[model samples]
Target: MSEHNTHIEEHRDDEASKLGMWLFIFTELLLFGGLFLVYSIFRLQYPANFHESSLELSVTIGVINTIALLFSSMTIAFAVTAVQKKNNKLALRMIGITLLMALVFLVNKYFEWGHKFEHGLYPGSDLMQLLERGHHLYFSLYFFMTGLHALHIIVGMILLIIVYFKVKNGSIHHEKYVFMENGALYWHLVDLIWIFLFPLLYLIS
Candidate 1:
């Protein structure tokens, strides 16, 4: 009877934790949705300017980042699967890979942003120079929106690191894997955001 009581308590705790994570995720979506609405309104107001600004972006770099995020998403999915199967070693390795990929994506973003700065194309900086030459409002939105998304990726990586340690120490097992699953879900959302950002910012031309 005591063992059954303990099991019930554990299940209750797990469900509560999962609920909290989902709530947190919902809030994040709303925040990002607000930004998306702003972008849409601005794009409609200045369609030509936005298109011209987007031309300054490096499609090649954007493609590379997309591929990296996709690979990281795959790694996280496999990590969750490994944990479900009770394969701790494999799960650890998968998490490590995902972290590395996230780092690579950030590094690429650093260079991309640096290049923009060198060319005098950042938000609210030398706007006259770009606008006088041609339309640049699109590029302004591009940098701000995508830059915010990159920040989210960094935050997601930090969460993944925490989950990695928990799984390594047996805090996350098949019976108590909600934390890992939620973490993976968040990471996938980050990847999904980038997927949409890439096409909208790069390929729409």
Candidate 2:
């Protein structure tokens, strides 16, 4: 009877943890949804400027980053599966691959941003100050939105790193992996946001 009760309690705890994560995910969606709405309005208001500004971005780099995130999403999902299968070695390998993908994305972004800064195209540069209103607003939103997304990437990376260590130490094993699941969920959110961002900021032009 005691063993059964413990099992039930553990199951309830898992459900509660999932529910909490969903609630938090809902709030994040709301935040990003509002930003998306604002972007839509501005894009409609200054279609030509948005197009022109977007043309300044490198579709190649954008596409590369997109692919990296997509692969990372797959690897993280695999990590969760590996844990469930009691394959700790495979689980660790998958997490390592996910982290590597994230690193690739960040390194690409760094070079892209550095190129923009070198040309004085970033926000607050004197060149930006002289741009037309529409152009100015477009770049402002571009920097703000993408910068915000990048911060989330960094946070997601941190969370995955924690999950990695936990898995390595056997805390997140086959029988108990709510933390890994939650980390993957957050990473998925990060990837999903970029999916919307890629087309809106890069391909729309």
Off by over 4 Å in 2: 1-12
What is candidate 1's lDDT per residue for 1-205, written digit by digit as tens?
Answer: 5655654443347677778888988887787778678777877887777777778778899899999999999999999999989898999999999999999999999999998788776777865454743255566567777888888898899999999999988999988888898899889889977877888778775
Predicted candidate 2 versus true structure: per-residue lDDT over 1-205, tens digit per residue: 5655654443448888988998999998888899999989988998999899999999999999999999999999999999999998999999999999999999999999999899988989999999988899888888888888889899999999999999999999988999999999999999999999999999987
Residue 82 in candidate 2, Cα distance off native in Å: 0.2
Q: Model 2 lDDT vs. the true structure?
A: 0.92
Q: List the residue pairs that clash in candidate 2.
A: none
**TM-score of each candidate structure, all chains considered together:** 0.87, 0.93
lDDT, model 1, position 38: 71
